[model samples]
Target: MEFDGKTFLTALGLAFILEGLPYFLLAERMPTVLRFLSERPAPELRRLGLTAILAGLAVVALVRW
Candidate 1:
């Protein structure tokens, strides 16, 4: 329950790396991938976002437990 600044920052930095890797590694395909995502309906995007959040939470819970 206590705040740990270093651990928090490390996790945040890892998240940034994970989020940026696809765009950095797939420089060419990113435009097409982004175009496909842009065309998705709002509800669909919301569902996908929720699914990702839940999955990420599950992993974090397992790791921290």
Candidate 2:
């Protein structure tokens, strides 16, 4: 499929909304959650991040296929 600026922008906007939703809905608990994450080991965080990246890529690949 051809690249489209509007579709790209829409996807980015949706990502932003999803990223912000947790913070907006759980404003009070966010600080504690952030602190918990901050205290996690670097290796663990890296693994979690890598997992998320792979999961997102898999979803995109499935959608494109």
Candidate 3:
């Protein structure tokens, strides 16, 4: 699939809204993301993975928005 810059950004913004929606509605049963962040003993791998996720999301958001 190929999308121009603006189309890519709109799709990305929708994705973030969708992903964050579940967590917003299910705060009591937080996703692994939340749990890992709260854990005092989080592993290095977990931090790296989370950083990648956030960075990727940021790029998509900026590009598409």
Candidate 4:
């Protein structure tokens, strides 16, 4: 995807925020998710991460186009 200066900056800023969400959202449950990952591997984590990536991409796409 492409982006202008402001779009890229905004997407980058939002990405920084989103990257911190699980920590904020699952304060006490953080270990649970970590342990779950240790016991069972799944693609959901990757997909969830990709969702944010796609969100940034979409923002850039919209802003630049």
TM-score: which candidate is best? 1
C-alpha lDDT values of all predictions: 0.98, 0.97, 0.81, 0.82
The 10-residue segment with the lowest total lDDT in model 4: 36-45
TM-score of each: 0.93, 0.86, 0.42, 0.51
Identify the superior model by TM-score, candidate 2 or candidate 4: 2
Please give, for residues 1-65, the per-residue lDDT of candidate 3 as tens digits: 77589977997899899889878888777867677666656587688789989998899799879
lDDT string, candidate 4, 19-65, tens digits = 79999988899899788877754687787779977997898799879
The alpha-carbon deviation from the true structure for residue 30 of candidate 4, after best TM-score superposition, in angstroms, is 0.6
Query: How much is 41 displaced in model 4, in angstroms?
Result: 3.1
Candidate 3 error regions (>4 Å): 1-3, 31-65
lDDT of 1 by residue, 1-65 (tens): 89999999999999999999999999999999999999999999999999999999999999989
Instruction: Tell me the lDDT of model 2 at 41.
Output: 100
Query: What lDDT, from 0 to 1, does candidate 3 have?
Result: 0.81
Better of 1 and 3 by lDDT: 1
RMSD of 1: 0.8
When summed lDDT is taken over every stretch of 10 residues in candidate 3, the lowest stretch is 33-42
